[model samples]
Target: MGISENINEILLDIKKLSPYPEKVNLVAVTKYVDVETVKEVLKSGAHILGENKVQVLTKKHDELWDYSVNHKWHFIGNLQKNKVKYIAQFIDMVHSINKLSLAQEIDKRAQEHNRVIDVLIEINLFQEDSKEGYDYQDFLNDIPALLTLKNIKIKGLMTMAPYTDNEDLLRNGFKKLRDLKDELNTLYFNDSLTELSMGMSNDYKIALEEGATLIRVGSKIFE
Candidate 1:
């Protein structure tokens, strides 16, 4: 199957999962797909492409520009502060914003790059020691510091739900992220926090039902 087939399948699956008619975004995670494959995907009406690493995105981005294809570029991995300037030059959005210091660094670098950075507040809602996010209690604390960043806008929340077959946990984790996203928007102190980037190949259906505006899927589209 190719990009069109994969996109059609994901869309049909999303439509079957919810009745709200939410325009879910399918970011053709390009961490694995090659340039020719990406060109084929672009021909299939797929625009948004996600890259998980700064170096990989820079390399692929340079390669893609040679094809003269204009598409949204999203950085969906851990971003180091030192690389923010270079990363900001290519990416349209960053989805792994986990700390205020990083946010501040991104804001500063984006200013130098003359681009306003759109970032998602990543939440380790499951509290996995191995993962990163603002904890439940520290949520309020994170919000204020985030608001202080002038060049960066908080678009929404992104999270990595615990790897589990338990449907309830999966659903609740997504719901929690939605609830947080809504609350951040309600603060009104900052602008609207609308985009929720959650879910992946295995649990995207549940994530969409809970209002995931952006889904970073890999294997499903890669195949």
Candidate 2:
């Protein structure tokens, strides 16, 4: 299988541009793309893969049956408490850990599977009434609730900037998440909350510039 040169080029570019140690986890979002395509991406040296829907991920996870390396799977979409068991089984990380109840379920399921699940708390930057993310104002109040959840460990904060092309809004939103991570870190998490998961294919570079330790990229690579 041949790897995508275009994707590799972008990864090379991103790897070089990142100032912090090459420690960031570049999650290759494989939503619309095919499993064989992802295999080629894996061949291109991508260790982590991200999926949006649990059902879709379940299929992808089964289809990619024999990847030999440390291929980690990440759930990057809104996860319901009911789907916790399936996700905890194979996903190495969960990026959209929203409700505290969902987090509790994940902790319980992960513990059942004897695994430590890494998670990123999602904050709704757009403030959309329909969106499922912790609001900025309520964040401090919710910290204790988040900490009490079991088995799952918070790696950092994740936020999806409103779907707009506004550079200013994007910057401020990304910066806010970074700042939130800093504020959260001022306290201790025993395990440590060190990752700031922001940005996608469109604004990942800006996110990297703003201290995002994890970038969930899709179309840029999968296309």
Candidate 3:
């Protein structure tokens, strides 16, 4: 199938797997694809584009500026403080705010742009040293401070499950993140933390089954 067909199939599967399909956002990870390929994704009806690197995202954002009227650009990777200035002007939603200092930098840049950027606190549930996110326990202890930032809106939580084909590991990882989101919402945000940004091309169905509000799919459709 082509990109459009792949997207259609994924969207259909999302509706079948997700408890709240209407609220679930399908973010097509476009980090590996080029500008024209991204255009093809937009044409496929996948309007939310997710990119990992700042330089690539900024370049695509400028090249695809016309599509901005109908699309949203999401930063879905480890963001640096210095690089925040590059995409701070129009980043639709940041799905990888992993630390307090990073959140502060985003807040400062968002203030300069006079915009409130929506962000998700990334949690390294598996505590992998290679992963870029707040450790599970650290995030719990830091939420109070993270919530105090003025220019960035804390949307919810994001986590990447360890790369594995084991269904139990995938489900448990996604469920844990969902549960964490619920716990934080009840304890602090009062049900405001609605999004669970989990899953990717390999395990999105499991993520959706476990209540992921945002699923990032790339190779499945783009490759």
Candidate 4:
């Protein structure tokens, strides 16, 4: 199937799971794909494209200058402090902020650009050695300090469930993220914590069912 067909199929799936499909953000993961492929997805109405590396995002951002005005670019990988400068001016949001120091650096870069950068706190639900994010207790303890940052807005939470054929495990991880988001809202009295950036091509349907506001899909669409 073509990019358009794949996107339509994904949208249909999202509709089946989401109470309000219009509100759900579909971010197409563009890492490793060429600019032409990225444009193909964008042309198919996948306006939000996520890139894992800042250098790649910068190249694509420049290559797709005309389309950039119409689409949103997201940094969805392990962002390094020095690399933050590359995306500071163009990235629409950062979806992998796990530490206060990284958040502080992002804020500093955003300050330099005179823009407020939207960010999601990545939660390491199972403390997996491979994933990067804050544990529950650390997140809670850092809330006050996170709130003190002026240039970064705490949008919500993001998590990557273990890649498994087990549906139960997938649902559990996504559920925890939703629960944490709710808890944080009540504890912090911040209603802006609305986005739940969970799920990918493998388990996005489950993610939607569990209340993921932003679903990052890659291979399925690109294939």
lDDT: which candidate is best?
3
Cα lDDT of model 4 by residue, 95-118, tens digit: 999899999999998999999999
* Candidate 4 RMSD computed on C-alpha atoms after optimal superposition onto the true structure: 1.1
Off by over 4 Å in 4: none
Tens digits of per-residue lDDT for model 2, 1-223: 1246756766776677667737677888888888888887888877789898898898989988576756889898899888777768778889887777778889899889888899988999778887778876677677788788668888988988666678888888888887777777876564388888888888887878777788888877755
- Give the candidate order by descending lDDT: 3, 4, 1, 2
- Across residues 137-182, which tens digit of lDDT does each residue of candidate 1 receive? 5667777677778889888889988778998999998998888777
lDDT of 4 at 57: 91
Better of 2 and 3 by lDDT: 3
Candidate 3: list runs displaced more than 4 Å: none
Q: What is the TM-score of each candidate against the true structure?
A: 0.92, 0.91, 0.97, 0.97
Off by over 4 Å in 1: 188-191
C-alpha lDDT values of all predictions: 0.81, 0.80, 0.91, 0.90
Model 1 weakest 10-residue run by lDDT: 182-191
